[model samples]
Target chain A: MYDARIMPKPAPKKHLSAKEGESAGGRVTVSIHDVASAARVSIATVSRVINNPHLVSARTAARVQEVIRKTGYAPNPFAQGLITRSSRVLGIALPDIHGEFYSELLRGADAEARSLGYHLLVSSEPRREDRGPANGSLAFGLIDGIAVMITDAASNLLKEAKGSLLPTVVLDTDLHAKGVDSLVVDNAGGTREGVNHLLASVPASSLYFVGGPEENFDAQQRASAFRAAVAASGWKPRADQVSFGDYTSEWGERWAEEHLKATGKGVFGVLAGNDEIAIGVMQAASQAGVRIPDQLRLVGFDDTRLATLIRPRLSTVRVPMAEVGAASIRLLVRRIEDREAEITCVHLPTSLVVRESSVPRA
Target chain B: MYDARIMPKPAPKKHLSAKEGESAGGRVTVSIHDVASAARVSIATVSRVINNPHLVSARTAARVQEVIRKTGYAPNPFAQGLITRSSRVLGIALPDIHGEFYSELLRGADAEARSLGYHLLVSSEPRREDRGPANGSLAFGLIDGIAVMITDAASNLLKEAKGSLLPTVVLDTDLHAKGVDSLVVDNAGGTREGVNHLLASVPASSLYFVGGPEENFDAQQRASAFRAAVAASGWKPRADQVSFGDYTSEWGERWAEEHLKATGKGVFGVLAGNDEIAIGVMQAASQAGVRIPDQLRLVGFDDTRLATLIRPRLSTVRVPMAEVGAASIRLLVRRIEDREAEITCVHLPTSLVVRESSVPRA
Candidate 1:
C-alpha cells in the first residue's frame, strides 16, 4: 500500500490553503502529508520512518528525513497519536525530584526513554485534590505507560494507577499488585551485610536501627531486615532498639542526641535507614564527644554523595539507584510493547562499601 | 452554544460500539463522547469542563464530572489537543539534570507547571547526531512551549528551539535572541561580591579566579566580573592570575596542585567558579599542608548542598536555581497563553554567603 509520488519542490515558506497547513492562529503549520508527498512516500511510511525507523528501509528513511528537513515539517504528535493510539510518551511519577538520588534516577530513566523514542512527562509533586480530576486522568489519556517510584506503599497514585488498567512498573515498593511489574532494591540483603559488619565489633544490645517514616516501604524493608539480621545472629529483637522518624539528618541527630543523653556513655553501633540520617547521627555524636568507629560505629543505607563528603566517610550499602531507574523503564517498555508479556519482578542487588566510618574492632 | 439533555442512566461496563469506545484491541476505551452523552451535555461542553472548568457553570461541571467517574472516562489528550492546538505540556531541556542545582530547578518548574494545569516533558541529555531528526522534531510536535537551560552559549537545542516558532523561554544563558524570553542568574554581581570579599583579605596579585569552561555564558560573565573587580580595586589585572577549566573538583584539585608545585610557598586567595572546584581545592590544599582561611582563603560559586556538608563550610555565592526554574516556567506559560506577548529577560539576583572558607585579614 505504498502511494509514492514524485512531486516538484514547493516554494519555501509559501502560504498554504486553510485545509493543508494554515492553523487557527494563521501560522504555517507544515503537516506530515506535505512531508510524505514531497518525499515520494506513503503517509504510513513517513509515520513508520519517524517512529520506528528500523521497520523502514534505511534509504527510504533517509530520503523522508531529507524532505522533512528541507520542508521543516513537524508532525503533530497529537494527530499521529490519535491515529496510532500510541502517544509514544511515558509518565514518570516520583515522590520528589530534588535530591542527588532522585536526579540521577531521572537522568537514567530519561536517557533510556529517549533512546527508545519516548519522552518522559515527569510529575514530582503528589496529586492534590484542588487541581481537579483532570490532573489524575491526564496521564491515563496522554501516555502509553507509566513508571511510578513509590516511597509509600499506601500511595493513592499507586491505587489510582492500578485501577486505570494501564501498563505500569512500580519501584521500591514490595506490594506486588496484580498486572503490574515491580523492580526493588535488595533492602534485606544489604541491611544484613551492614548489620553483620557492625556486629563484628559492637554488642547486639548496643546496636540500634534508626529508620525513616514508618509508612515508607523502603524504610519498613530496611527495618525488618535489621531485625531479621539481629535474630539470625542469635540476638533477641527488641522494640526499644528501633526508632522510626523521617529520612532526614535532623531526625538522626535528634534521635542520637536523645539516645546519647539516656545512655550517658558507651560504645554503640547504629544502622541508619539512609545516608542523610547517618550524617545527622555523625554530627550529633561528634557534638556529644562520641568519636565515630571508636565510641559510635555506624553504617548508613543508600551510599549517596554524602557518604563520601562527610568526615570519616560513611560505610554503607550502595544502592544502584540509576540502574534501578533504568531497569524499571526497560521493564515498563517490555510490558507496553507486549501487553500479554508475563509480569516480572526484578530485585536489583545492593552492595556494602566500607569506609572510615566503620573500621574493624581493632 | 449549550447542548444539554436529560437521559436515562446507562449501564456501567456495557460494551460500546467501535466508533464510540471500543478500540481495535477489543479493550473498552471510554471516549469523552460517551461521557458527554451520558451526562446530557455537548462534547464541547464536556471539553470545556475538563480543560477550562472556570468557564463552565459549577453545577454543570460537577454533574459532568460525576458522569465521568461513573463511566470511567479518560478523555484522549490527543483528540483534545488536536482540536485546541494546545498540548498543555511544556518541554524542559537541560544540559544535565544530575546535580542539586538542576534537580531543585526541575522541582520548581514541575510544581509551577502542575499548578497551571500543564505537564512537563523533560530531556536532560544533549542531542546526538546519530539520534536522527525525530529526536529534534519531537519537542516541536509534542509540546506547546519550551524552556531551555543552555549551559553552553552555542547550544543546538537553543538554536532549534528558537527556530521552532514555539513560545520559548531560555535560562542561564544571555543570548537574548529574537522572540525568546531569557532568564539568567546575576553572575556578574555575585562574582563581584565574592572577588571583593577576597580582595579585602589578600593582595590582587595573590588572588586567582578559577572559572568553568571558557565558552559557558555564566563562566564568561563571572570571569569578566572578576577582571572588573580587580581593576576597580586599583590593581593591574594579570592574565596568569586567572585560569579556565572544567567545572569539577578534579580540575580544581589538579590546578591547585600544579600552582603549588610551581610557587613553592605563599598565601593566596582563590575564587572558584563552583563549589565542586572549591571542595577539590580544599582537599588538595589540606593534603599539601596548606590550611583554609590561614594559608589559602577560598570562595566558590553555586552554594549547593555540598557547601554546607563540607567541613569548614564553603563560602560561596548562592544562586537561586529553583526560583530560576520556577520563573522560567511561569514565563513560558504566559507566552504559551498569549503567543503575542513581548519577549522578556529576567536577571535573578545571587547573594554571597560567607562561611568558614574565607576569613578577612586581621
Candidate 2:
C-alpha cells in the first residue's frame, strides 16, 4: 500500500486499420488491448475469454485474467449500455455548494435517487468560457436526467444545461423556458404573510427591509412582496428603508448598523432576507445595546437550524428545502421515463412561524 | 414556457446485425443503427454524415440532420472515450449529507475539483445488502478518481470500493488498508488539550465526558484522549462520569440533564464530543438557571457555526473541514494520475478555541 514509485502509465492511442476500425487492442480508452499487451496475448483472445471462456483454453484464460487484475481494466460502460438504455444516474447542477441550502437539497435528492435505484452526480455552474458541447457532454453522457438550481435566473449557467437536452428540473428560479420543469417555493406569499404578522404585532414607526442580492429571483420576489404588504397597510414606506445585502450574517450586521445610524428613531422593525442575516442583526443589536422586541423587532425567512438555536429564537418563514429536492427528483425521473409527459411547475407552500425575537414578552 | 405536458422521449437500444457492426455505426448500445433508423438511411450514411460530412451529399445530410434533431439522439460516450482518455469527473462517497460538516467538506472538494477541470459525482454509502459490484459500477465507470468518508471504520462500505480498484482517499477513519490513502483530524490531541483547558480555567468539582456513538472512530479517539488527560492531571475521574450519546444536540441535552441530576454539587464542567452536543447542553443548563462558566463550564469539538451564534459563545476545538476536503482531493488526483504513488495518511492539526462559555467573566 505504501509503494511511492508506482505511477499510472498513460495508454497511448492506437490507430486501427480502416477496414475494421478496431484498434488492435480494445476500442475504448481502457481497452482490452492494454490487458492483452500486459498478458502477451492477442486482443481477440482476451475478448473471447471474457465473452465466451469455453472457446479459450483454461490456461490461457487464467493468464489473461491475472493480467487484467494487475492492470485494473474494466469493460467500457457504453458497450454494456447498448443492451440497457438507462445509465441509472441522475445529475444535480448547483451554482455553488458552500451553504446549508444546497447541502439540504442534496441530502433530499440523494436519498430519493437512491431509493429509486439511481445515484446522483453533482456539478457546480460550468465555466461558460470553456465553450462548446464538450463542457456539458461529460455530465450529460453519464446521467439520465438533471436538476438545476440557479438563484440568478438570468445567469448563463443554464445554457450548457439547455444544450445537454436531457430531462431537467429547475429549482428556486421561475424559468419560463420551453420543456423545462420548475420547482419553486411560494416566496411572495410567505413574505407577504410574515410582513403582515410583523406589522400587526409591532407598533414600530417604520419597517426596514433587508433584501438579498438584486439578481436573486427569490430575493426579488420577497422584496416586491414586502413593498406590497406595506402599501396594503396604507403606510408610505420610504425607499431608504430598504437595503441590499448578500444574504450573509456579516452583511446583515453591516446593513443593520447603517440603518440604525441613519435613522433618528430608536424604535423600528427589520425584515431580514434570511435566517443568517437575521442572526447577524441580532448579534449587532446586542453589541450596540439595542434590545430585541423591546427596542427593535425582526423577522427572517428560511427557518434554518440557526433560527431556533439563536437566543430570542427568530420568527421566520420556513422553506421546505429537502422536500423541494425530493420533489425535483420525482419530477425529473418521471420526465426521463416518460418522454411525452407534461412539463410540471410545482409551487410548494411556505408558512410564517412566530417565535421569541419577533414577539414582545408578556 | 409554462407548457407542462412535454415529456422526454427514451432512446431505444440499438441492435445491429453482424454485417452492420462492420459499418462505421460503432459497436455499442445506442449505436449509429438507431440514428440511421430515425434518419431513414443506411448506418454507413449516418456514420459518414457525422465523421466525413464533406463526402456526404448536401440534401441527404440535411435530411439526416433534421431527423437527428427531432429524435434528440447523440453518439455514445464509450465510443468517444476511445479517443479521450480522461472522463474529467471525480466521485465523492459520503456517509450522509444533512450536516454542516459534510457540506463544508463537499464545498472544499467541489471547489478544488472544479479548479482542476473535473466535476464531482456524489453518492451516499450504498446499501450493504445490495450485494453486487453493480451497485457502485455506475459511478466507478464515470469518475477518474474517488474520495470516501466513513466515520464507522468497521463498516463494509469499502468492500465494493476495493472491487472497483479506483484511486481513493478515505476521510476520518484510520483504516490501514493497502493502496488506499486516509485523511483524519487529530481528535485525541484536540480533545486532550480542550479537557486540560477546562480543568485549569474553572474551579469545577468534577469533569464529565460526553462521547458520541461507540462505532465512530473519531468519538472513540476523543474519549480515549479525555481519559488520558484526566489521568495526566492526577485526577481520579469516576467511571460514572463517562456517558455516551449520539452526536446530536438533543442527545447532548439529555446526557447533560442526567449528569446534572446525578451530581450533588452545582459546579461542574463538560467536554462534549461536538459543538451540537455542547449547544444542547448549554440550552439545558440555561433552562435549569445555571450560569455558564460560573456554575458549569463547557468545551465542544468541531467548532462549527453553531459555536459563535449561541449566547455565551461555545469554547471548542476547530477542525479545518474545508482544508481536509481540499487535501483529500489533491491526494486522490495524484493517486489517480500515478497508480504507484505512496499511500498517504494525512493528520490535520486541530486548535482549541477559548470563548465565553468556558472563560470566566470579569
For lDDT, the strongest prediction is 1
Residue A41 shift from truth in candidate 1, angstroms: 7.5
After superposition, candidate 1 runs with Cα above 4 Å error: A1-27, A36-69, A127-138, A261-267, A360-362, B1-27, B39-66, B127-134, B260-267, B360-362
**Residue lDDT tens for model 2, A1-362:** 75636855444456332224344653334567677766778888998888789999999999999977675677665555434555677888877533678788888888788778777887766444643454443366667888888788565656767766677788887664566888889998898888888887654247878978887887888988888888888887788767776888888889877776765655678889898889889888888778997778889999888887777889999988888888889988988889788777899999999998888778
RMSD of each: 5.6, 12.3
Positional deviation of B331 in candidate 2, in angstroms? 2.5
lDDT of 1 by residue, A168-281 (tens): 999887545565799999999999999999998888988999999998888898999999999889989789789899988889999999998877466789999999899889
Q: What is each predicted model's overall lDDT from 0 to 1?
A: 0.83, 0.77
lDDT (0-100) at residue B49 of candidate 1?
92
Interface RMSD of each: 1.9, 2.9
lDDT of 1 at B148: 90
